[model samples]
Target: MSHNGVQTESQRTALVVVAHHRTDSLTAHIGRRTVAQLEAAGYRIDFLDLHAEGFDPRMNIEDQPDWGNREKPYSDEAQAHMQRVLAADIVVAVFPVYWMSVPAVLKGWIDRVWNYGFAYGRSKPRLAGKRMLWLGLGGIAGDDAALPAMQEALDGQLNAGIAYYCGFSHSMVGLLPDAEERPQRLDAAGNLNIGDAISGIERDDHYVEFDRKAAGFVEEFLAADRVPA
Candidate 1:
């Protein structure tokens, strides 16, 4: 299952799911940038814009039943979304943090897509061996006061509860206050006025670095040849 002495094609595709309602923000730019980076790194990329795609995050009455033969029925739209997730070697979720959690659209995407049988609940999990990376944007500063709580939430609630529940190893990256706002250089006290700092950044290079970090993670994982633990 090797392609050019590396992982197979099936193992080099990364899914990029962006759950942003607003398209004009720096967060959206970062999301797009991430895709570009992974693509350039020779990994196939699948991008999902949950809102623009009209994804329904809410579960309906048909989802629950009592002791009967069950069918996992997804609309063509939903099936398309699920397939993208299924085919990926790695999954990247980019969204703005709201109230210390993912945006509703992203959360709903998880609730709907990561179903019982599809994402988990078999002797061998469906999403097993997959790795996940979370990219979050916060309106608050990236200091101890604002970041630690969010980091805990990501590690405990999202990573542990959601991703690890489905048998995926996870890593998270947070670009806070706005990617465009951070200072080009941090001060003596380690305080960064990110919004002011964004003005000096080279957007292209920034995206390149971000993508390299992400792709590097994927490459290391594949080289290790270990399933998700």
Candidate 2:
């Protein structure tokens, strides 16, 4: 692969999954940016726009796990998705943080595709040594008092509970708050507070900073792969 006119031997593939219904959403925009960055970094990108591809998150009988059979055959759709996962050296999931967690579609995608036999339920995990980055777009204000606790909760749920449990060598949750056009926060009494939306240069600057911060998260994630683990 070549990056910036420099030829290289690394040919890593990154499965960049975007779980947003609308193609014009901020989440989707960030997802596209992520793909571009990965490409520039010499990763062959297998971009999976779940909503556009009409991925049915609903679990069916064919995809259901049979605890007794660890090598059960899942639905064709599920198997196809699993193949993509298997082909990738790294996985980056970008989505809006709904209810302080991933959206229903993403959760269901995992429930169905990342099934017991495929992602887990074995002494030798298939996803072992793979890296994962979850870039969740959040609506909460950047300086909200609840931000720290929210980040901690998300880290525990996504990194510790799911990724590490599934045997991923490294997994990170890059929570990008201030995603909403109108700022939002929670008070000490747990009341929702919505602030005015910025316009003109303010809005432009806001998104500029947002993009920079988002890029920083992705860069940091990539840099970690170079370190000894």
Candidate 3:
């Protein structure tokens, strides 16, 4: 299909999910930057800000899945979200990392919207060919010794555990550490170390590099989707 001289399939759709209470947060900033980059790459953006959209992260009876029934009916809200997921060729989730995993909102989104009958439980999965990118913001310092382990664990959870289980064709977790203005790391004794908050040109430079790294990740994700036929 073509619109305004544009091929609808060529100009694919990207569903960008942002899970943050405040729009001014670094997670939200990265989410916006992601949207801009995808848009510049000619993707039609369906930006979903979970908090701003009043998405209920708490699962209710209506959305609960029946273990025996793969064709179970879900709540209207969950159905709507499923439609959004179905419409997009790619999904980009931007959220803060909590306890080395995605925040509750994003996790609940998976629980509710990515339900058994919809995102899984079928021989031919509905989301099989879709791609996903998890952009997680972490407060831990980039220099932290545990950073690599954290990344590995998160990848195992988000990529191997969730996305692949749901049959997504590709998924990548783009971790953005050092998102806090105050430097945070762990000591040799496994104690949390906190440094003084940064300001002035230093703070500006900090976020500039952060955004640049985030943009690089988004670019890489876009490139991955454009693989040769």
What TM-score goes with each of the models?
0.72, 0.95, 0.95
lDDT for predicted candidate 2 compared with the true structure: 0.90
Q: RMSDs, each prediction?
A: 5.9, 2.6, 2.6
Colliding residue pairs in candidate 1: 181-194, 181-195, 182-194, 182-195, 182-197, 183-197
What are the per-model numbers of colliding residue pairs? 6, 0, 0
lDDT of 2 by residue, 1-229 (tens): 1123333466888899999999999999999899889888888888899898999888899998999998998989999999999988899999999888898899999999889988999899999999999999999999999899889988998999889989999999999999999999899899998999999999999999999889999999999987986
Across residues 1-229, which tens digit of lDDT does each residue of candidate 3 receive?
1112254656788899999999999888888888888877888888899998899989999889898998998998999999999988999999999999988988999999999889999999999999999999999999999899889989999999999999999999999999999999999999998999999999999889999999999889888888964
Error of 1 at 27 (Å): 1.4
| Model 1 weakest lDDT span, ten residues long | 1-10
Name the runs in model 1 displaced over 4 angstroms. 1-11, 64-71, 171-229
Report the lDDT tens digits of candidate 1 across residue range 1-229. 1122245535487788888878987668777877776765677767777887788888765443222433466556556666888888888888888877888888878876787667766668888878787777666653445567677877776778888888875554443443434533345687754444443357567546655654564455444434433
lDDT of each: 0.67, 0.90, 0.90
Supply the TM-score for candidate 2.
0.95
